[model samples]
Target: MVVPEPGLPAAVTIYEVGPRDGLQNEQGIIPTATKAAFVRRLLAAGLPIVEATSFVHPRWVPQLADAADLMTALRAELGDAAAELPVLVPNERGLDRAVELGLRHVAVFASATDTFAERNLNRTVDSQFEMFAPTVDRALAQGMDVRGYVSMCFGDPWEGAVPIDQVVAVGTRLLDLGVGQLSLGDTIGVATAGHVRALVAAFAAAGIGPERLALHFHDTYGQALTNVHAGLQAGVTTYDASAGGLGGCPYAHSATGNLATEDLVWFLTGLGIEHGVDLTAVAATSRWMAAELGRPSPSAVVRALTPPTE
Candidate 1:
């Protein structure tokens, strides 16, 4: 039983990333219908924001190659509810694809470390900004809300222990480019509670308020939840989580599952915070997704709460 921290917000907004980030890293290709169904389930479970797909070149993220088809299907099925979907766009071309599909929300990803930028995007950190600038600008100009993702903000697989100032600098650039919110990712899940507090403090000191920041933690070291608790204490009200704890970075081989939505919901509920997510529905979705992946869920909450079959 966890006690509610006095400074924590009464409510938090969870940005569900399972559809894009989670399935992108899977070994097996999930059918387009299944992916679409997954998104519907997540919405039905009450997640306000769901990352639907990435428009990166198919050669890069083959799992989400069906971005167009998936979005088309979802737009048709969800109608007005489709407004909640956000797709990841790598550049002008990706953004064009998203725009063509009538997407109102999009996300652009960047890394705080040069090595990761080179390996992941085949460009230096600065070059990535140049590549992403036009997309960010165009998206915002078109009246679409943009979200920025700063990968390896806590620690990089190649560089290790990225400076908080460096992350802040990159994040500030993203904000300057007109991203409504910036999600700081502990890409390899190396952050502790202390690190989370310090990083949030640094960002706050730099004039970026908690309202403009979100935390995305991987559960590689079993510290995702602890860091989330610390994030709550720091007044960050937005977080990125995956259902069924699905997903890991293909570039960062050692990285593992993302912080599970179920686990975070359990923590938030125990702390008496209002997240507007149904724990049982999310757990059932996790169980169903785990079955799709042919594995047990990595989330402890899902495991313990899931009922046995007769």
Candidate 2:
């Protein structure tokens, strides 16, 4: 039997980002039907919270251009489970689209550094707040729970090694805008365990508890799991991960795959943390998704557990 680790939450919430963040970076545009089926499979695998799709303009992210179609199909297929789905909204327009679809939850993204903000959103860091404020306020007023994603919280490809204070400031602004949760992203995966601890400590010092924060790390330098360990040690209970590790930032060219869902589930299981996610089911889903994407599973745990076909 596994033993509970000190300073870790008895249960953790795994925010599955495969259908949205994972497939969004793929070169091929996944069909809306395929994407909807993928979301169903993830829900069947016991993921309570799954990012469904992004409402970004097709010119920017053509892969998820069928966001509306996907949402429609998911609502029809998943029924009440559809309530757990959250879509990404880039602006008020995106939020409007989400509201039209009857979405009750949405996520808005901002970057820690000016370079990333300018490149990713075509706005400066400060301007990003201006862009997001009205959207966040509108969403909250509509009774929609908003989530804030702070990208490049650890390191930016253009601007390396972001300062903790800068990340905290952006996070504070997001929270002030009434976002219920903030997900700190290691976009280029330059975070270490120490960085995770320091960032969480800084946020805590600013009165933002770990309960309101989620950690999203990529495995570019192979430190994603280590950073997750640090986050758990620091009392963070929510984490964002992709099945089969299927994502990279198109804007951040050097970014690798996200922290794999299978890998994180394995770690959580060993730590005696109750995540309510089935590791075997997630591994199977990862393998299936890798086949759909025409790539091998990027998750080490999935590869180890899944037998190869002759």
TM-scores of the candidates are: 0.98, 0.98
Candidate 1: clashing residue pairs, number: 0
lDDT of 2 by residue, 6-87 (tens): 8788999999998888988888877788888888888889998999999999999999999998998888987866755999
lDDT of 1 at 72: 91
State the lDDT of candidate 1 residue by residue for 241-295, as single tens digits.
9998999887888778999999999999899899999989988998998898888
Runs in model 2 deviating more than 4 A are none
TM-score, cand. 2: 0.98
